[model samples]
Target chain A: MGYKSKLSWADVTPKAAYLNRRQIMAGAAGLGLGTIAGPVAAEVPLDREPNTLEQITSYNNYYEFGVQKEDPARYAHRLTTDPWSVVIDGMVDKPGTYDLADLLDGMDIEERIYRFRCVEAWSMVIPWNGFELAQLLTKVGVQPSAKYVAFETALRPDEMPGLRSPVLDWPYVEGLRLDEAMHPLTMIATGIYGESLLGQNGAPLRLVVPWKYGFKSIKSIERITLTDEEPPTSWNKANRREYGFYSNVNPNVDHPRWSQASERVIGAGFFAPRIDTLMFNGYADEVAGLYTGMDLAKFY
Target chain B: MALKDTINGWARKLPTWPVYALGALPPFWYLYLGFTGGLGVEPISELEHRLGLLGLQFLIAGLTITPLRNWTGVNLIRFRRAIGLLAFYYISMHLLAWLVLDIRDPARIWADILKRPYITIGMLGFLTLVPLAATSNKASIRKLGARWRQVHWLVYAAVPLGAVHFVMLRKGWQFEPLIYLGIVLGLLAVRLLRKATRMRPHRA
Candidate 1:
């Protein structure tokens, strides 16, 4: 089955070579490949050019791997993604560890291109290949009492060096209100650039909440618990003042140190004009109802 | 003795224009990298960081001149102005990079300078540099006389403030920025210790 929509962009990442970062990096490290091939152009129409494969894969803030932007790509290759299992429990009918492949055995995967905004005021538009989280939750049979969906990233200290350092509480956690979790736009991404997700970009499994700050979309998920209680998030736990529970993309709400009114799009050339950040990062029409009558400034 | 004097004389005779030319290289290299798509993924941010560090390095170099002569007797005072002016040039570029590239909106730029502590200190450093840079020429030095030296002492304040600004810019226990602060503090210690020794009374 295939899914199609009017929401399209002039720039689509060329499918073939973007996924092979590990191969290229390995080749560079004396595996005998001389050239790192660039992403070839494709005919997918879009408004603006997507960040290059290098930009998308390399420049990321996966604190689990490390703080520096290049740290993830440099370090995440050690992570073991094959035969991954996700432990699902708390207010679910089917409460057990499910193999990643078995869980998504019958689900249809579609490429949903959405704007990803980081709390640090950098932005990117990524084409994510995954099914809606709503479908997954439906598959698991959600109990009526479940109000929030809590996620826990895999805590492999040896594989993830940053985990050894006291960056935050271990097994980095993130949560979403059940409605937000069940939203059509909210996805459990398995891939990008039309290929399987790279280890650095949260391979095997990761949450993708396009409307929220990039940190809210937790990576390398090992557990997803459907619970009635509000779960403690990693960033909010680390510094509650800076990172709030509801990390919605609202330009009006300025981060304590940096203004969120505008963002410098990564890979946009040297003098490229900074674009004004939109309400809910241009997904307000779809997600604003989720936060109706609530003060985003306070919640943020 | 003759060779040492000849080398020193040659160094003294060297044109100051070369210092300015050499001083321009780092930014020029960064500019070339920017135009050539070689500044990695985020060029503007990279350029902003590199330019700031270059300014700080030059500031440290300028501050070293007095101590260098005092401790080593190398006597490189003639190049101090060129070095200081170069520091100001890089500092100005650092400020402009933040202004025009990083934060494109002018209103937001003013707001950031006013609101954020790091930005405020950084702006203060830049403000102090402006007067020093303006009066760097031979004409202003002659016109102002001793008052010029007093005014240029703003460098003492500006350099440390810039270090503080840098330290505060980073998040959570960054050692690199703190190391920079350490270098500034170390230089200040040398200046302070020398001042204390000069003030001590000597017996016949």
Candidate 2:
């Protein structure tokens, strides 16, 4: 049974408020107003209202900044995002360091409102602004031999205090199967609520895999490598027993330390009930085919 | 020695009822924060964590009293029972926050306590404190005599288990929980070493 959210659409600031903000930012950037019109209406099923911008930006899991939720907001501002570039290599036709703007130049950035479930059994409904990861892979021309896609976050000791902690090995890495990377639902988000992504929220670029746990959506990405071999992910490498490579949101496959059966909704007030967690975070209709016959309990 | 004597004088005059009254304030303050948005977006978890940490701190503080008295000659012995009861109070609140505010479902709570190793360890630690807290009064102390000290010795097991629970709950091998574990182990070691030295003289 799908658990309904206690929150109502009216409780949250309307999506139009952020769209207007985006329009102003887009106007200033010399982007045509026409580009925003087409994708704003594209719907992804959202059971709950999107968290407030303050709630989203203030509470983050970008551990490169620090392990604490608020650490990202406090320390990420020191990161230099203006001159960011992504190095895309390994089995890709166009394997070069591409400037952030040049890479996203012709791509269609759209608003996808998705339920983001963390492995810690808490969740948020985020309104992310970006295009599908498939578009980027298609543009880069993925080789037929490429089986897995590896991603790496920027490692700057001067800017990232959490790097000193040796939490999950410096320069946190993540991976997805080539098919997963090329999935239409997979997005490389650059902004939220029509504003440029806050540095704490992975600022210049981050991955958003809605069906999987939040850690699968690596933040502040610096490298993308398409490889024939299955790539090692930081969390999976750190504790293989607890974190699997797939890390899909299955309520049945519990994290070793906590139950995944239900999740507390962030910004849903103090007394709100923990809603039952869904298989693949309620994206089972769209993404369950990706894991058809595999035993999720074993694979998880 | 003069400074120690002066501190002990102050400690003697210090009424422990104030500690009970004051130590109870933090959980209420955390509840207030949860209501007022001061505990951030995920207040239930934050509240649970803060209460658990405070419980551990009080447990550690209670453990330190005997060592502090033996080493520094500063008597905090009068406040030990009060500190220990406060620890039990905070820990009970921490468990309540998890059960009532966070989980709410009885089946889930039961499943978590059984399945999750960290939660199992935490429940074990909480269980260890129950008998000690129940027997912490003057009546039980007088009735049980030497057995009261034996029952309270359960603190040795409870503190370490609580620290281990903290260590296991964190995402990775974090130093904060490790440091807490280290402190607890060190305190236990100090007690053991003192016992060893005291026995050595008698054996010799």
Q: Pick the candidate with the highest DockQ.
A: 2
- Chain B TM-score of every predicted model: 0.92, 0.98
* Model 1 Cα lDDT, one tens digit per residue, A168-192: 7788899999999998889999988
Q: Cα lDDT of all candidates, in order?
A: 0.81, 0.86
- Tell me the spans in candidate 1 whose CA falls farther than 4 Å from its real position: A1-46, A163-171, B1-17, B65-78, B137-146, B171-173, B189-204
Name the 10 consecutive residues with the lowest summed lDDT in model 2 chain B.
B99-108
* Candidate 1, B1-204: lDDT as tens digits: 565567568768887789888888998899899766577777888898889998998899989888876765566788888998888888888888888767756677889888888899988998999899999889999999999999998999999999998888765545578889999999999989978887785531
Which portions of model 2 miss their true places by more than 4 Å? Answer: A1-46
Ten contiguous residues minimizing lDDT sum, candidate 2 chain A: A36-45
> Considering only the true interface residues, what is the Cα RMSD of candidate 1 after superposition?
7.4
Clashing pairs in 2: none
lDDT of 2 by residue, B46-144 (tens): 999999999999999999999999989999899999999999999999999988777776777888899999999999999999999999999999999
Q: What share of the true interface contacts does each candidate keep?
A: 0.39, 0.70
lDDT of 1: 0.81
